[model samples]
Target: MYSQEETLRSTIDKSLKVIRLYDWLLNLYVLDFFVDNHWTKLPLSWQECFQNITPQDLGNILSEVPTKHVLPLSFISLIKAVKSLSLPRDKISNKNKIGLLLSEDICNGHPRLKNLFLKHVKLKKRHEICLMSKVVSGVAVESKCDAVVDFGSGLGHLVRVLAYNNNLYAAGIECQSQLTEEARSVQLVHAYRAALERILVDYDPKLKHAPVRNIKHSDTMTFQQYSTQALSRLNIPLPACFARGEADLRQWRRVVTLYTLRLALAPLVETVILLDRVLYILEHGLSCEIHPVFDPKLSPRNHIIVGKRL
Candidate 1:
């Protein structure tokens, strides 16, 4: 129920908290805790510091991605906020939300797009794509741009909603070719299924009661062929760039260049990015709004940075 604006503001505050915590922890001789050194091998003070990590404290920090073996950003904030006189040195927190968007909110969006979501996506994915679509759509509307490029369009969820639901001309740029192909498959499947439904709806009344065993079986066999021929079978474009290679993440300066070249003169052109694993990116002459994008209880990493090219 949190407004996107509020989410932006609160999450920005939280992101700063995380940045502060990281800075604070670095000077505490906690760098040993960051490296390969074992707990027993660390200095006694370090051991005591970690030993203070209680079950409750652990719970608080665990809210970040545990699977990555990295400390949760919120936990970082928690550590800084609770720094003791017994141990000193540190500062920073860039509140970032961490979780997939949910389904119920998105499925109720565009009806046909919802069908694609329901048919092709998992629950977590459904939510993520749906929520992402909303965020991008809002920005796209304000930015007045028809083209959308999703940086790491994993599995094409965000791209799916963007292209089909939001009616944006979307292109998903992914590093992995296999995922790009898989996303194309999902897109083809939806198109094929939609084609079949149209046929069913147009079926003659005289044949309406005819056995659907063939129809059902045909659906099963269609995917087995998995042909590029599917393109000829329908007008629905596969929302992907099949042969597109990995992007040069090392060259971040291009983001600013892009804004200067295209977005600078526009009143509301914007730069939007997932502020995880990297700090927020900004172009000069632009304004940013940071928001807590998700229900915090579900994901502490829910902060988003929406920077308008003013």
Candidate 2:
């Protein structure tokens, strides 16, 4: 019999296989971490080269067959080492921007389908959204709630995944224009493609049915419309009300000042969600659990937060 941890990992791995990009990303994430810790040291010239490349150019480079499989390991190690060095946040940000550009470039150089696959793939980070989603779903299943609301949704990825997987009526509140725009773009691309596919593909009893419906793309709408549209598209009755607003961390008694600086746009959220900070949620009438979804060891903040309305 497999341990719960092994079972969870197996489930995630199987799910990941369905999405080529996610599969590659998962492998890359592990490989990158391994290389960063144990592989060849990256030179200053290579670091400069990485900083200079754009996403499209990086995509092109990734498209070509690598001379050695071990090379990625060395490159990833260099990135980690650089991050470890005493550098200002701005410098790190610049480096990351270059890395993203490289990633995007590599993605673009791939086939259209592969590009689409990679588009949804994201680096594994300390995200509570997945755990929060599961908790919300479980609570809803028990209490028969109408919808789940995610506040301060960055790129709306969590909401998207929840609605897609659980057929839940969900809404996201996003304050950042850039992240909102990106989320909207992703939503449109996937929604439009799914709509087109449904129109073209005839129903077949032999094929497995797709679980998620096309999410309606709207800008700055009331929570009601968002929930209604998501439910209506899936031919489900609308929930009475959807969840709204971002999670609050202002109520936390003890929190780091650096957290405020990090979450300038959404300051009162760190203590409410961060792993080291999640105790506050429990104090504020929420339950906490560390579930296996992503690699937790990669970051201390990867667990999810589940709160029931008191």
* Candidate number of the best lDDT: 1
User: What lDDT, from 0 to 1, does candidate 1 have?
Assistant: 0.42
lDDT, candidates in the order shown: 0.42, 0.39
What 10-residue stretch in candidate 2 is worst by lDDT? Answer: 245-254
What TM-scores do the predictions have?
0.41, 0.29
Q: Give the TM-score of candidate 1.
A: 0.41
lDDT of 1 by residue, 1-310 (tens): 9854555445445545444433433332211121222234433543444443443444443333244234444435444443311111111123212333432444335666666566766655554455557778899899998898989877777776677667889898778777635432123112233333223333343422222222222445543233234334444333331211012212223222222212211211111124321133333445665555544333334455677777
lDDT score at residue 211, model 1, on the 0-100 scale? 26
> Which lDDT tens digits does candidate 2 get at residues 1-310?
9844444344444333333322222232211221132111324444444433444444444434343323345445433332333111122222123233223333224455444333554554213444445556787887678688888876666676467656788899987777534444334222222222222222332322333444555556544454455435454333421221111122111112112212221211222224333444545665544433333333333334455555
C-alpha RMSD of each candidate structure in angstroms: 21.9, 25.0
Please report the candidate that would top TM-score against the real structure: 1
